[model samples]
Target: MTNLLDMRNLVAGYGYGPDIIHDFNLQIKKSEVKCIIGPNGAGKSTVLKAITGVLKPRSGAVEFEGKDIAGKEAYQIMRQGICFLPQERAIFPNMTVAENLKMGTYSLQDKRLAEERIHHAIETFPVLGERLHQLSGTLSGGQQQQLVYARAFAIQPKLMLIDEPSLGLAPALVEQTFQHIANIASSGIAVILVEQNAFRGLEAADYGVVMDLGKLVFEKPANEVLQDQRIRELYLGKAAKQ
Candidate 1:
């Protein structure tokens, strides 16, 4: 089967700066979750930015559904069924939960379909439903994260580009965040996750990708990655090698 998303030979960086991603290549099947883990400055997040058009690739192709999407505007790429959740919390603090969800469907032209999706999101995350009228800023951090995920869910994107989903959460909330990612993947949406917590990220993913110095070090099935001695020693620490 054709891959859901294919990025080949991607080179990108901010304007006038040296490239941070070098000949990066990645591919994911529909509904598969690929987690990228590496030390700081490894360009993991740069790959997402290139694919999502936040930083246009200086070279190579980003293909989704067999069409090249390289250099398209972020909104254009999003409208074509890709949702990007940055490392920071994306919820609008001033908006009510219901209003936040409504914004998720902003790209959809069909009002009825948007409403249906909103209903589906609420059903999938009943907590969001219960908090619909509450101001998002007043919600707890975990609840606010839930609102972020719910909004992403409402969009029903074919692919989700998630950058550091567990970046700034209490340890207890971290597991809950990964569960949300798993839930999204289970619903048949491909996910490209860049996470700081390597072990947890790989556990939630079908595949584990390791990168360093702006290049891919290796890619492997998540289980194999978790078991590989070199990977364990390098990324997961000496304890993981036991």
Candidate 2:
């Protein structure tokens, strides 16, 4: 697989406070999922912020498809075939599902192509089709989350930066969300996922990375990381095995 993104020696922080992400490095290949896990304030989300242009990196390079995009604006990054969806509510509550989905195609220059992508996204997530005319906020939590992904899918991005996608969902919904996320990655787009459910996140990912205090502590195949006894004890609880 070819490397779609390469974030090397990333050192980022807020204002002049201090560097929260220190010499961090990450790479993702097409059609792969990389999950980042750690305790609260471990700077997992910070890494995504730096990559997505939400926070400028103090040093190092954020190379995507071979070009450096470290200091680019968020919109510029989006136009570069990278989509960042944060953990917070991403949908327009007052807009109908169809309207919100259509809004996703605003970046497309061709109306016909945008329409085609919207239709394709609806096919991928049928719930969006069912709730097309309904206000997005009227849908259930799981349904709203599905819509968020559906909108991203409409753009057909080369890489997606997703943060805490299953943050406040029920157990069953969380499982379903990860399933959809895995499906997206399998469909050929690389994904950088920041998830609170460490075990489930790693289970759904191709690569697993453990971050502590803004630095990577472990990097390995997802299954291998899951199998490590110390890692299992420290981050993923023993119950993760079952």
Candidate 3:
């Protein structure tokens, strides 16, 4: 299958800082979900930043749909059908849920198409419809996450770069957040998920990518990664051996 996004030998860092990602490589096919898991400061989130143009790579290629997008602006990348959800909840806190959804379509040139997508997003997450007039910050954490997903859906992005979907969430909300990711992939959107919770993240992914100290460790089918004894011991901890 043709890859939707491909990164080769990416070396990226922020503002004269030492390189956070070194010679990183990755590829995702259309409609595939790939979860990136590693310890803190392993450059997992930095990979997402490089791909989404939040950090420009010092060398190497970031090819999306056959175009090199290494140094492109974030908005430019978004316009080319990539949506990025950072570690923080990306909603406009003071804005109404409806307004936040509208912001998702900012790059869309066709008004009618944008409205259609917004309607589709609401249908996909009915809770958003119910809270359309509510301030986004007032929603429960899970509800806020749903709004974020709804907004991304509204954009109809080909690829979604998600960093730490389960971060700072209640245990119950963590499960729900991964479910939202599954739903997104089911709709034919490719996703690169950087998650701290390896088990939960791998569970929702087609493939598992392991990283350490700014480099790729390995890539495997999710089930294999789950079952690999070394991965179990090193990343999943003692419970994984049981």
Candidate 4:
């Protein structure tokens, strides 16, 4: 239950733009699944960006394992034991799955070490074992999501920043993705998921956070948030209780 991610009074934004995320704070524990839910423009993705070093924090801190990586570049942060598999397609569509896995470890110094990590990743995803030579673009949306996940795991990251992982998938595929995410947490890597599907996201996460307009609104156990009528009505709307 050691804290893995710590953002205290975090304020971040694009260059010269207004702070889309300010006074943000959250903590994640080792091997835990934490989900963040909020309406659009709530800075959910921005939090991920800042944590993964895609955006710099104008003030405050983004610490992982007590190391501040606020101004580090994206690749530098990856070397710091954090990897971000963004909501967008993170793989090269034209590349084979094997190639994508290789691309993931571009920062590593040893090929054999990278391959060893990739072997472990295949253990968690047997379907990928058979599809090593397959082109990423040819895979289904769910499979593509899995491929991106495998690529992220190829380097053995300590924490994963997943943004809207279920975006643009079929219902069954979304379910599959969420299940995979749960499996990921069991593998002992802490995961922070930014998802728009609040209900499903909370169902897969151990902890839940509700953000509103760039501010922290509610912080509670996933089940508590799931069962709370007022919270569901406020953030999830009419379909929440269903």
What is candidate 3's lDDT per residue for 1-242, written digit by digit as tens?
A: 88899899999998989999889999999999999988889999989998888888899999999999999999999999999999988889999999999999998889999999999999999988998999999999889999998999999899999999998999998878888888899989999999888888899999999999999999999999999988988888755866
Candidate 4's C-alpha runs over 4 A off are none
TM-score between candidate 2 and the true structure:
0.95
Clashing pairs in 3: none
Which candidate leads the pack in TM-score?
3
- Global lDDT of each candidate: 0.92, 0.90, 0.92, 0.86
Q: Which lDDT tens digits does candidate 1 get at residues 16-63? A: 999999999999999899999988999999999899999889999999
- Stretches of candidate 3 off by over 4 Å are none
TM-score of each: 0.96, 0.95, 0.97, 0.93
Per-model RMSD to reference = 1.3, 1.4, 1.1, 1.6
Tell me the tens digit of each residue's lDDT in model 4 across 1-242: 66788889999899999999879999988888889998899999999999888988898888889888887898888898898988788879999888888887888889789888888778777887899899989987777888887887787788988999888888888888888787778889899999988888898889999898899997999999888888788777766756
Cα misplacement distance, residue 68 of candidate 1 (Å): 1.2
lDDT of 1: 0.92
Candidate 2 steric clashes: 0
- Rank list by TM-score: 3, 1, 2, 4
Clashes of each: 0, 0, 0, 0
Kindly report the root-mean-square deviation of model 2 from the true structure over all alpha carbons. 1.4
Q: In candidate 2, what are the lDDT values of residues 82-183, reduced to their tens digit?
A: 988898979999999999999889888999999999999999999789889999999998888889889999978999989998888888988888887877
* Stretches of model 1 off by over 4 angstroms after superposition: 238-242
